[model samples]
Target: MAKDLTVKDVLYALEYMRDALVRTPISDGRARWNMRLTGASVKESVANQVRASGSVSGIEDTGTQIIVWRVAA
Candidate 1:
């Protein structure tokens, strides 16, 4: 059976993934916009959690549970 992820694990995974994304800027702006616009719910959820935790960057959630965090300027 697949290992189940706890809430903490999911959060950490999302954060880590967002950090990794920061290192490489996405090439396709349209695709990025589409993804972001389409996944509003996921982004909002991540953003809410990050905000509650006092994180630096703003989170852009995609509704599919995939989070994209903006690196702090």
Candidate 2:
């Protein structure tokens, strides 16, 4: 069964999938504006989480997706 993911879990998953994920900019079409807005909101939410957690090293924006990496202590 699939499990619910916490913010930390999501961060870890992003790190693990970094290499496999790609970000592509949405096309400049009115129909796609909503999707673009939704993506931006999700990115902002992730960014907020990263800022709250010192465990996260940084985030990379691929224009299509965000990747989170852990900080090495």
Candidate 3:
């Protein structure tokens, strides 16, 4: 990863991975992502992406992992 990568950059990465994320199974209306110390900026980018997706009803970020709730099937 390049130094000085901003949330916008991370968000772009997430956008590129949208197909993969969509393929990830969602059980019980939620999808969990284990971020594993990737840092706050990446987590924030994920939250912002989820919000922009307009599919998930809620988002829970623990600064390490993310649990996206109520994802549209």
**Highest lDDT against the true fold, candidate:** 2
| Best-to-worst ranking by lDDT | 2, 3, 1
Q: Candidate 3, 17: how far from true, in Å?
A: 2.6
TM-score of 3: 0.28
lDDT of 1: 0.35
Poorest 10 consecutive residues by lDDT, candidate 2: 29-38
Per-model TM values vs. the true structure: 0.28, 0.32, 0.28
Q: Which has the greatest TM-score? A: 2
lDDT of 1 by residue, 1-73 (tens): 5443333543454455443111113555312211233222223344444435534344344422323443422
- Once superposed on the true structure, which residue ranges of model 1 sit more than 4 Å away at CA? 19-66, 70-73
User: What lDDT does each candidate get?
Assistant: 0.35, 0.40, 0.39
For model 2, what is the error of residue 20's alpha carbon versus the real structure, in angstroms, after optimal superposition? Answer: 9.8
lDDT by residue (tens digit), candidate 3, 1-73: 6464454444444444332122122457554442223432333345456556654344334432333333322
Off by over 4 Å in 2: 1-6, 19-43, 59-67, 71-73
